[model samples]
Target: MRGVWYRRSAGRVQAGAVLVLAGGLLAGCATAPPRNPNNLCSIFQEKRSWYHAAMRQEAKWHIPVSVPMAMMNQESSFRANARTRRTYILWIIPWGHISTAYGYAQAKDEIWHDYQRQTGAGGSRTDYADALNFMNWYITNSRKVDGIPVTDATRQYLAYHEGWTGYRRRTYASKGWLVTVARKVGHRAQQYQQQYDACKDRLKGGWWENFWDWLF
Candidate 1:
């Protein structure tokens, strides 16, 4: 009886270990690039459209299409209606403030305020259009007054999550899960770009199809 029990326990442990390893592998696979670029733009367009329209206001700024998309990818996995645990719960309050963030872009109250002041344009923060417009303001401000040369969107994304004050490569720490999320999003951003470029000029949807067609 004892031998039988011991053998059963060992089998359970081995099975559990295998399950854990399998789970990790599956998670990695979702973020991994597909063998083909089929519907890559379709996956990205919702997020890209938001940023592309936002960036259009600043014709000279050349906000890289990859930057905002990466941020959106990281911050919310392109789910415009996504929500974090804290947003729905009063889990833990910080020293100074209570919960004040919401939306596809994860705009906190403080950050949203900065957006309003910078652009003098108003829209609901939870709305995707507003999120794009808000980021548009942030990128323009960062590039112009801050003199942050718009070289790579990934680094700019890090700074966006971290902050411009200590944006230097050495000083930056991704803060909590931002590192994990950014790594995945950053890689996906690069993947999306390559896939989009590969499908160059055969743009998926524009005037060719109405916005409603893109929805469902």
Candidate 2:
């Protein structure tokens, strides 16, 4: 009876250990990405690290947080897994989605690869930090190569959409629709700058802000 009882207790302990391990795994997986990303305050509230990520980009690349935030808002509405729509055939048939532009910045494969190579960053577009950094790098380089001021969200976004070569050739000039969208992006960036300035201190003082305080 003693031997049998000991075996039963040991089995129970093993089962409890397995349950605890599984519980830990599930908890780790349960950490969701940010919600209500369109609203800058909600974004910071949902994932405070985002504020730090933006700041990091600005400090490193001299690109404002509002610039990339506005670009992401226009590109993907800040959806991490957003994809461009596919053109339809006969206004009814389905087609493959346009470009490999995914995640917040909607960075294409070639452009994203170049960014990774240049920055030594191991993150993908789905990562807010990586996306924000990519935007800064793009904007900063645009300033250097194309003389598009980083602060001028209009020309920066035009270069972003049309590519530096296309922007130099005035390709966007012919695309009235694209020009309109770039203007909107520029306006939104200005608004975000004002909004960020108003609440940045409070945002930096949040409970989770300490995690990245040292980095900034």
Candidate 3:
């Protein structure tokens, strides 16, 4: 009888361990964002909070959602911890990166700090909410200072890469590569807008949405 009881207890312990492992795996799947985050639908599907955040930014800044999403895709490929390549001297020196730009929007140090202070967002660059908001703020400022249309991704991106003063001086014309890149960003924004339109209603409800609602 003692041997039978011992075996039953061991079986129960093993079952509990299996349950724990399965629970952990489910948690991981719940928390992990999608890979290859280039597609707008995939991105929103991976984390629905991003969709809400984009909507919030557009409403707050009067900028289109596609604009910031495309610009961020260009700047960081949507990498949460992206950084600029390090400079090298004589092809061997171990110099640090050219700028302090990092995270999704790749915002530089001073501008990022100014954004934080002005907006009181206080979120890190890795946070999509913060990055999108920063992009909207920058683009809105570009519209105001440089007269670049909010919908004009090319000039707005040019002014984004170049400062407002440099854009006013037509600095982007000197850089053909930047001009090409800006045009591509503009096109991507149009694509994202189309993709978002297709899948928006279906993406309305989920655990992430519930969590965000509870959070906010």
Candidate 4:
């Protein structure tokens, strides 16, 4: 009887381990970055849910889908687990990350908490939907707080990288590299806008097509 009990306990442990491994594999697959990060249409085609989420955000926030999507691409290349590079200690050993920015949006810890508190939404940065929604909310607020136009991806990204107060203080003018990066983000937004215009109707399929896609 003792031997039988021990065998059953070992079997249960092995089963639990297998279950944990399976869960990890599924999560890794789910968070894998898109194959074509440069092409907005291809990215959306590959991830229909992302297109839907972007459309939803646009509808709710009155911000164009291309703007935030472009900013996110610049931020993380759409990688779900992206984060700041680690610092080095004494120029040799590795230290903690330079900043607390992480996940698809690379949002800092403080701003992320502010988003959660203001929106009352519970979600992690690793989730594409949540990150996009957070971008929408923050960009909309930038327009309200800083008078930056929603269509001006350059200024909007400046405000995004620098807080509203920093934008008001014109701190970004001193950071030439940051200003160049913001211009690149703006160019990418224009590219995404053209691509989105061509494919949006297809993405928003007929009811039956939507149902079929949902079923599959």
Candidate 5:
């Protein structure tokens, strides 16, 4: 009877441990990328929290919602745990990543640290809200430092990819590919703006409406 009781207790403990481990793994896993990334309205409809976060950032930073949203799509395609591709060793084995840029915005470690220090906000890069906030904050500062307008997604993306100093020095002129990519980002921003204008009314509401939606 004692041996049977001990075995039962041990089995229960093992099962509890397994459950805890599974919970931890689930917590650490990245959220799956949105299904329809091309359409800004579809993306927002699928992820309502993302719309709220983007609106909050836009309200706080005065950067247009379309600009950072387009840039983020180019950077990470809305993947929460996105990182730079790894470099290969001898064209076979995987080595270190191209840079320390990580999470939804592809923000580098040094620049991300600077953002935290300057803003006095604590947040994780893997979090969508934090990433959107960081991107808008960087764009707002870019406007201040580089004289680039908030709505000019092209120059804003150029300044974002190249540091402000690099942008000031016109380094993007040497990189034709980057220049093209920036133009693409700009085009996407325009598309997002058009789409958002059509559906923004539905997204906006008073606190009670928002609360009701949350409950449902």
Candidate 6:
């Protein structure tokens, strides 16, 4: 009888522990904004700092805010530590043969090396913010040669997708895949902007009213 009682108490303790852990997870999810809310396959979230930093970088460098955001969405969905070194997309089959790209940004060999030299940043090798910074520098330079405004996120985004040579050449055949990717990124960026606007509009009570009203 005592053994049965002790076993039941132990089981209760384990159940309680599980419940606490589950609750903590739920709470974290509730507070953290999702990277891909539509795709809940991964239990991942984006950081707030990157959003602010990317926005500031765009304005400061005369780049586009949507460009970075869109890239983040597609590249790693703003997941900072997005793994890029995984060679196995499938358990038995490896993804890369001769070359590989890693990080939230999915930078390849030359890009990884260049970014390391230029930025003095590394880790996860694929973080979206690092990727954003890299593209910010790249696009700014590419825009001048391509006769496109670096401040125009939409155009610059397209240019970044196409690379400097492709942008300058305007090689439609070479840019076919890039064009498709850019269109998808544009749509996703528009969606995200709309979401941001809606969220601002739905600010709870007078909490954000001061800031909003102060603006306009």
Which is the leading candidate under TM-score? 4
Best of the two (1, 6) by TM-score: 1
Model 3 lDDT-worst window of ten? 29-38
The 10-residue segment with the lowest total lDDT in model 5: 25-34
Per-candidate TM-scores read 0.59, 0.79, 0.79, 0.83, 0.82, 0.56
Candidate lDDT (C-alpha), each: 0.60, 0.82, 0.84, 0.90, 0.89, 0.59
lDDT of 4 by residue, 70-139 (tens): 9999999899989888778898999874889999999999999999999899999999999999999899
lDDT of candidate 6 over 71-98, digit per residue (tens): 6567665454554554676587777664
Residue runs of model 3 more than 4 Å from their true location after superposition = 1-36, 89-91, 95-97, 206-215
**Clashing pairs for predicted structure model 6, backbone only:** 84-102, 84-103, 103-126, 104-126, 104-127
Residue 212, candidate 3: C-alpha displacement in angstroms: 4.9
Over 1-216, each residue of candidate 3 has an lDDT whose tens digit, in order, gives 999999999999999999999999976654354574567888887776777787767778888888888898899877777888877889999786488898889999999999888878788888888888888989989988988899888788999898899999998888999999999999988888888889878867778766776589
Per-residue lDDT, model 1, residue 168, is 55
Off by over 4 Å in 4: 1-26, 89-97, 206-209, 212-216
Q: Against the correct fold, how does model 2 do in TM-score?
A: 0.79
Alpha carbon lDDT at 5, candidate 3: 100
Error in Å for residue 52 of model 6: 3.3
User: Which has the better TM-score: candidate 3, or candidate 4?
Assistant: 4
Provide the global lDDT of candidate 6 against the true structure: 0.59
C-alpha RMSD (angstroms) for model 5: 4.0
Instruction: Give the C-alpha miss distance for residue 19 in model 5, angstroms.
Output: 9.5
Clashing residue pairs for model 1 = none
Model 1, CA-based lDDT = 0.60
Give the least accurate 10-residue stretch of model 6, judged by summed lDDT.
39-48
lDDT of 5 by residue, 81-112 (tens): 88777778799998864799999999999999
